[model samples]
Target: MTYRPTVRGRRLARELRRLRELQRLTLQEVADRLDWSRATVSRLETGQTRPKPNDIADLLDLYGVPSPQRDALITLAREAGQRGWWTAYADVFTGSYVALEDEASLIRTWDTQLIHGLLQTEDYARAVITAGRMLPTTEDIERRIDARKARQALLNRERAPQIHLIFDECVLKRPIGGPGVMRAQLEWLLELAERPQITIQVLPFEAREHAGLDGRFTILSFPDPADPDIAYVEGTMGDVYLESAEAIASHGERFERIMKQAMSPEDSAPLIAEAARSSP
Candidate 1:
């Protein structure tokens, strides 16, 4: 199926196209140099096909991009490839999540309500979307739910990015979709916790002190030599993308503080299991 590029994805694609033009290299010329099909290069530059690492490397060399510029391009390529499952639900969700998910090499998420998108079950996703009174038709909601399901695939990749998730105790106690849905969600969390690359923790409501109490945010870190880190904060209308060094640094510090305040993964599992037992 054809995909509509997210705003951020489109922006990145335009940047790549501009770079190519500045170098005075035609698409066919670059393709011939990389031994890749012209269509492939065209797709990458047009944001049709997501750019892969190898493709970025070849393009950088072909374009004679400097080391710093090459690294940035490669990072953008990696982010471009991260079309999260959410893209499928493009009709529902704003494009912000897809863009942020794509560029995040390491994601630190804090969930105060439903399970984080990366860990939600289909049932949980449905419940969460349906709960949104402003959402449109059921078909659109289901599409978004499915898109969220697809996004989970990234966590299962062989070289999946590191995911550190912190949840408030309310997420466990407050029944989103009800007992059955919440139970399933907890089970899914338990299953996800088994993955070596994922760390799940919960901050008990009793934890009088917590950095995340003010609000929730995610810090997305990319591989080296790229533009500095970014902070994604969501709201009712859309989301904000913060890339300034000071903003990124502040979010990083807040994430570290919240991580320290939350219970350890080892300790959090039993709590999750206990919640699951009591769920429905």
Candidate 2:
């Protein structure tokens, strides 16, 4: 299984590389000194491999990291190495989205297609995963469904993230799991909208050629300033995680524009309720 580095993992990787550079040692020199392969050293510095505490200790010793920073980084390495709930269904979720999403304190998203995954009901998720993934086995489909269910638990946690969703009008009309399933999903959306932490908006067709013509994306903000914000773009080819300040700022502007054009949460509630009631 490929190790998808989390924010802490990436931070630890950067620090390790910086420490080595400070000592003016090449990767080969470090590997030779530690009796590790050059490739192993490279992978650790690049976050391509999980950092073992012992391995991190050795690297710190080589760099003479000293007590304060050395202990801190080793602790970070242990946390980075810890497995999350999603790891159990690694085959289902092939990216770090779930892992990162688990850490977010706020989630903002714009959807041109289906409903946001967090708000999706079990049946709706099953439908989406089945049709989109083309899984060959019932067991495989169930496993994916289970993973999505686990992910939704984040919303109900004691300190759940503030979630705001802006979806195109067409998403309300698209019946993914047929009329009955779609109706249930929409009704659930209505129920969830009543929550204080959740906000929903609909971008009507009248607003033509808007900023969202590009596609859908989600921005995740963390409580810790050190973690920074993340902008995620999902694609059929592969998902993209944008962390740079410029990239995040650009996506932030796009989302703000989209939100401006979308119906207010108050106005959107009636529309969502109407869609749910009208769905037969």
Give each model's whole-structure lDDT.
Answer: 0.77, 0.92
TM-score result, candidate 2: 0.93
- Residue-wise C-alpha lDDT for candidate 2, range 83-183, written one tens digit per residue: 88888888878988998899888999999999999999999999999999898999999988888889999989999999999999999889999988999
Give the clashing pairs for model 1.
Answer: 85-151
TM-scores, all candidates, are 0.72, 0.93
Scanning candidate 2 in windows of ten residues, the lowest lDDT window is 1-10
Which candidate wins on TM-score?
A: 2
Give the per-residue lDDT digits (tens) of candidate 1, residues 1-280.
4454544455567677888899888989878887889998888777776567786787777777888878876876676566555655666565465655654678888867757888888888788778864466887776777766667778777778898999899889988888988998899899989988899999987788778877888887765443356688887777787867899888899888888888999999999999999986
